[model samples]
Target: MKTYRYLDLITALFVVVLIVSNVASTKVVLLGPFTFDGGTILFPLAYIFGDVLTEVYGYKRSRRVIWTGFFLLMLAALTFGLVNLLPTPADPQSQGTAQAFSTILGLVPRIVLGSLVAYWVGEFVNSFILAKLKIATQGRWLWVRTIGSTLVGQGLDTGIFLLIAFYGVWDNSLLWTVFVSNYVFKVGVEVLFTPVTYAVVGFLKRREGEDYYDRDTDFNPFALGR
Candidate 1:
């Protein structure tokens, strides 16, 4: 397998973002009128990372990183659940600590399902759209591909995740509100950070000498080709 100096770094960062975002999602936050989970603050960075990967390294590499994140996230979830289930010794401090641990690390089945499924679909969609756009535009406009892909990808992600995680649990109106707010906030993050994304993508392209255009590449998400 070929190695790039920064691919490993980016992949590691990508997984950290994914795992941390999911963990932070347990806490809901309200800033004035907008209601969102803590994940919203950092989840958008994952999409930016997606854009950077697909833009600089192409979809094949990006797909690999996405799968890496998915599996690591599942492992983290399983580990958290396992730890949450382990019997803790009966003591004043221990009991309090165990309860706090479960409160923070516990993973509900529906939420787990929503998170994994939505992430797999959303990230592939983002990478696939960006790859196709790169070819369609002859690589002229970076912003179009990044923002356009995020528009589609984040829209699907926000809607699918919220609906699956809270459809019946939350009021219909409230679910919709959360979905709309999260979607806007995520896409807004992509837009607001476009300058940074451009800088990173440009730097990587120059430094690594790889501006991949997936004209001949396979688009299958499951294929483990290099």
Candidate 2:
């Protein structure tokens, strides 16, 4: 296996974003017209990280990073769940803390499963689309690839996650509102960060001497290959 100067760093950051997003998702918030989980603000960055990883390191490397995040997130969820199940101290000062902790970090099986499935599917779709577009366009326009892939990826991500996580628990209207709002917000983040993405992609390519195109690469998400 070959190593790059910053691939590890980028992968670390990517996993951090994913784990934090999962933890933050416990809160539902309304920001103006948008009703979404607190994670909405941070989850978009995970997609951006996906774009950069696929663009600079190729889909193979990005796939590995995605799996890394997946397993780590599952581990985090399990850890939280176990901690939430433990009996609290009997002291007066800590009496209510257990309930608060459970309220915030207690794992809901449906939500955790939904998040994992949605992320797995959505990220692969995003990486696959961007890689294909890069080849088709001969790498002419970065914005087209980034924004276009995100439009589709985030749509499936937002819809699947919300439906699975909230279908029975939330009213139909609320579900639709969240799906639309989250989709728009995520795509908006991609568009807003296009310039920054360009800068980072260009810098990484030059410095790391890698601008991977998946012309001969495997698209299998399970194949962690070199």
Candidate 3:
């Protein structure tokens, strides 16, 4: 087995971004004319990290990282669900605090399932597209690969998550609004952060001596053994 210096750090950051975004998703907020879950603010960064991982480490490693984030995210939701099931103290203050905790951290089964499924599918899509684009472009244009993948990947992520989590719960108009808003915002962030993505990719490739191309890789999301 081969190892790199920053792989662990990048994996750690990727998982952190995923878990935090899931937590933030409990609150819906409006930013200017856009209305979305608070997680929308930070969730896009996970794709950027996904781009970096696929661009530098290849899709195989990126698959491992994605699965790592997925499992950890599932564990977090389970943990919160467990805590929410525990009995609260009978004292008034304790009851209030407990209520707040449940309100904030209690994981809804539908939302949790939606989030996990969306992330798993969307990230794999993002990584697969970026990896293929990298090969197609011969690594010439980083911006195209990053933005292009985000366009499709984020679309799927937003649509899948929204439909699964809130299709019946939220007003149809509001759901459409958030869907459009999230897709645009996420893709916009990818475009705006192109320079940063290039810098990070360049640095990681240089430092780690790897600029992997998935030319002959399995491209399997569950093929973690290799």
The most accurate candidate by lDDT is: 3
Lowest summed lDDT window (length 10), candidate 1 = 28-37
- CA RMSD of all predictions: 1.0, 1.0, 0.7
Q: Please, what are the lDDT tens digits per residue for candidate 1 over residues 4-74?
A: 88999999899999999999999888876678888888999999999999999999999989999999999
lDDT of candidate 3 at residue 166, scale 0 to 100 = 95
lDDT of 3 at 100: 94
Which residue pairs in model 1 clash with each other? none
- Estimate the overall C-alpha local distance difference test score of candidate 2: 0.92
- Which prediction has more favorable lDDT, 1 or 2? 2
What lDDT would candidate 3 get against the real structure? Answer: 0.93
- Cα lDDT, all candidates: 0.91, 0.92, 0.93
Query: Which residues of candidate 2, in runs, are more than 4 Å off?
Result: none
Clashes of each: 0, 0, 0
Per-residue alpha-carbon lDDT of candidate 3 for residues 1-226, written as tens digits (9 for 90 to 100)? 6789999999999999999999999999999988889999999999999999999999999999999999999999999999899998899999999899999999789999999999998999999999999999999999999999998899999999999999999999999999998888888889889999999999999999999989999987878997
Clash list (residue pairs), candidate 2: none
What tens-digit string does per-residue lDDT give for candidate 2 at 6-54? 9999999999999999889999899988888999999999999999999
